[model samples]
Target: MIGYWIIFSATTGNEFSYLTKHFLFNFNNVEDIFYRNYGKRAFIMMKIYSFLLTLPLALLACIPVRAGVYEPDKLRVYLKMDKRVLYSDEDVVLQICIKNVSEKKNFFDVFDSIKNKPGEYTTFQPLVYDYSGREAEITVPYKLEKRDIKELIRDLERRMVELAPGEVFIHSINLKHIYKLDLNTRYRVKSLFYPTIGEDIVITSDNELSFKIIAEKRYNKPSEREAVQRNISPSEVILLTLRAEKDKNWDNYLKYIDVEKFINAYPEYTQKYLRANFEEKNQIEKDFIKYLTRDRDDYLLHYKIMEEEIENSKRIAYVNVIEDRYGSRWNYRYRCRYMLEQYKDMWLIVDEVATVMQGAKR
Candidate 1:
């Protein structure tokens, strides 16, 4: 019986002292201040007997107790991230959820470290923030036991401290731990039990907060070498006409074709137009046969020859070409950038602009 009381007190942190005395102790031995008197005896003979006679009745205290069964408090600690995903330099929000299983209110302070003594419970606070700046600390209101209400408060301060400006940041949260309600009998009897626990729940987040650089333009090369080192391929430039012909997009076709290159290359047609406009003699008839039958292969070679002749006159050439001969008008201009590469070996030209000029005089 003494062992049973000892275990009960230990389990409840010695709070069962009243229950032990009133229910488990001998009623006759109790001296209520007003009722201090000799206990009633079954008989005069038994009364004279030693204390050992009542000792047997103490055995009744060992009746296995079944009163409030010791069930673990259903404690669930979890971390919840806000629905909005924050970008780099943006604020992050973390929510803390605490549940109490007891049928009373509980007060607890959630902190990163443990308190040294009984009075340090109220000294801890969590930091929080919004995207603009430092927000506020999250506080758990009076948590009612038995009935659990979910309280969502942002822990912005903790998140900001973990991530620095422009750091390779990944936002992940840990629940850390949980502390529950433990009754402090030294305080008010009405407040016999309060939330007394340690960190048990670790809250973590899978998605990280990141930011996108709004002003930066993403291209293949860096900014400094943009002008002198610009790469121009016939394939890239010729796409203007090919795409226009394929999708029949006249706007792009007109916008992209190289008019100057066409007139310079097709001298027979250019001379005929010049003669009609300036009353000079025309040379179109003399070159008519070659112009009509010239395929991409012949025309490209002639163009290469003309470019070389011009470079020869200038005394310098950036590129050289043996010939500019190509297959056909369509295939010749199809992404002519590649053709320019073959021609760039011996010819000097700006880019692979379109060879055919739309609406040009014959």
Candidate 2:
């Protein structure tokens, strides 16, 4: 029986090699007990017991090992855009930020300055997606002589910079010069970074940034006559808020908000809270715009008023807004309160409170 078990175990070397060594001492003790006390009658019973005990171990050994989802390296990279919406004539500024999250210092080769010439360091490759869903790689063109390349390599070899833990290195490049953009078309851009010229370590952006080119401004300053003629309601104010953020029109957005009433209603917000002193109305308006647009993009897919309550000159509305970002949809439900006031004989939006409901994401 022992010889039979040995032959069965030897057939599966790779799968049960480590486990066989672990169970060998115990199996030897069991075999000694069976041979000394029970003799031949218990030999067949011992063989059956050994087979049952090793069955689970054999099954476990056949299972494949899986790798972890997270990356082992401690370096983090991110890309940001200065503006989400741009004109065709304007240059798009793309910034790259790299940070070392590990405790140890890491060395990286970067193009800090133009010491010799071009082709000294690794260039960034940007992925561009057009409105027609066509994707293309846009590369920056560079020309370098043989001597320039040699000098650049020498410069890069000597210019290896050390990054301490939690330290960030930032670089900015103009994409408009590298790639030509079409007017009235939306483009999504993602920047890829390589830490070394040999393409050893690579990190991509956390999220892609998109920008739309417009032939003319969708939002403009309304004249005094137009402002007076427009009837401002709570629902209209909500619509204006969405349109203003979509157009990045801060000036037109401010017209719909009553700054004094908002400050008085939400007095907990101070200069430190806003990161800017709100001594002037313009500064307060800017701070308010920043608060409303925080962590949001300049595009809205859909919006609906979930519920509304109106009594006398006050109203409260629960609005649902959906935004599509990088092929993922995010739903934001806001509970907004509004107070109606007479301004130049027209009902204007005065005080307001906007709170995001819990579990607002789908």
Candidate 3:
């Protein structure tokens, strides 16, 4: 048994020694093989992982962004007239004011200045006062930006200096400018070729002008008024003549001379017709003469003396030809308000009130 044990122990020891030597001998080669083939695989894997991690960043760098252009808004202009009714050839004063609300550049020019041509609108420019007169030549270049405002004022005195005699100047404005913009490349869509934008700087501009010109004095002559001789109605003449004859001694022969007195009292009342020799025999002439002769004296003194004699002379009731006594026809004097308009030939009562004198100049 002891011999068998010793032999087994020796065999086990030799097997152990052989396994340890073989492991030590192949260790270097195994390491070399791992580093050559597997190392390359690991390096390749690392490169793929790095690429995956950076892929999103690379895509973000190439992505497009939107761009835009901006501009300011424009303002508008308005005008008004104080009066509209004007007499022909009358000199009128016009007030002009200009305003702007915007961020942009604009220019203006006026007519009448030597530099300005005919049919051109006027602008506010610097003027110089010299020995000769006030001269406007230097122009002001105006620059504005967003929410900016500009104002200009003018009076008729300056306007008259520039205005030509008998030449009518039509005032107006012009908006010929626009805002420019450069779009960002983000909107560089294939459909569009250029990166530009355009917008109106003036939201509201001068669309129309409110203006008027009038003459200082009326061009019409006073002689243009329709004129005629006053004539008493036949009924009135008859009543007045009869009253005169009744008050005095009624005599058939006295009637003839009384008619001359009646005519003298109310001078030239339809004298043309009375003097005219009409071929037709008419009762109107006889009746007219008789009517005048009857009240010749009293009719003549009615306004001059009779009205003065009557205490608290009753208001003489009057009825116009139109027969509308209730209609207003009088007005307050020196307190008349007026509107501007081309005066018509027809006469207009100052105000449609109810008490005043009806008078005519021509």
Candidate 4:
């Protein structure tokens, strides 16, 4: 019997070696004369059997050149988490970004054959481990390995997505939905990306993100957001937010600005947050705010209100501010423009756009 892949190769019009095709042509003619001579038929049958035995091997010997991010040199998979510590009520989110690093652009990406988005559909097959060295459970619809490799390869080749050099495709994975994460435990997530779906070609990113889930934080007091919300100008709101950031007053700092809207300013965050569930939305906010509150030397050093614009019958305002920022390694001066909106008596910063200035100091 012909092997399934041999049939697939023929049906798909995969070119065989010239010698193999020539022999196959002759073998087809030989099969018609089986009744004429038993001796000739037996010899032809032996040759046919040998050809069948070696066909698969021949196919393997000249495997097609795999496209996409198959090797470390071609692409990079980065796994990252905004928050390393989370409350039990929050979702554990992991961001997977695949970047094309090769000089040549790829027309077909690994994600094409995947049913939904890779991380969203659990096709990433992410491995999660608790602090105790026990792996978390992940139940999914189907395993790729059980399916026909030829089918996977064929589907992958058919899907065309142009990924240029330095371009990235990002996906989100919520471990909270995939794994049974328990409270008060630490876990590490390592992700696998398939540029070509196979055991040998999986790209295992060296990056691993670990986070701890503790009991819900209920003791934290609600900020006196009312204090900063009333009768404030756009420039004042910017100053207040900067002061709160410098003082490490996260609760009050986030109150001066629309946290969700500000985080959504980033394209990546906007894409994920727009489709997120209630729990995931809250987790995203927490991760973003918590990240901003973390200790860093790059806090706003100085800012000057360069210009201000108020419109929409004074309900909307914009402020152009020059800022100085420095970390242990580097320093930069930026010109930032902020957008603020007035709701009732409260003026809240909703958006900000910034550009770097090449200079010695502000």
Assess each prediction's global lDDT (C-alpha) against the native. Answer: 0.32, 0.60, 0.30, 0.70
Q: Distance (Å) between predicted and true CA of 82, model 2?
A: 2.4
Off by over 4 Å in 1: 1-230, 233-257, 272-318, 324-362
Off by over 4 Å in 4: 1-73, 107-123, 143-160, 219-362
Error at 24, model 2, angstroms: 63
Q: Identify the superior model by lDDT, candidate 2 or candidate 4.
A: 4
Q: What are the root-mean-square deviations of the candidates from the true structure over C-alphas? A: 27.1, 21.7, 34.3, 22.9
Q: TM-score: which is higher, 1 or 2? A: 2
TM-score, prediction 2: 0.34
Worst 10 residues of 1 by lDDT: 185-194
- Residue 221 in model 4: lDDT: 72
Clashes of 2: 0
lDDT of 4 by residue, 229-248 (tens): 55667788888888888778
As for model 2, its CA RMSD to the true structure in angstroms is 21.7
Best by TM-score: 4
Q: By TM-score, is 1 or 4 better?
A: 4
lDDT of 1 by residue, 237-258 (tens): 3533444434545555445433
- Report the lDDT of model 3 for residue 98: 35
TM-score of each model, in listed order? 0.20, 0.34, 0.16, 0.36
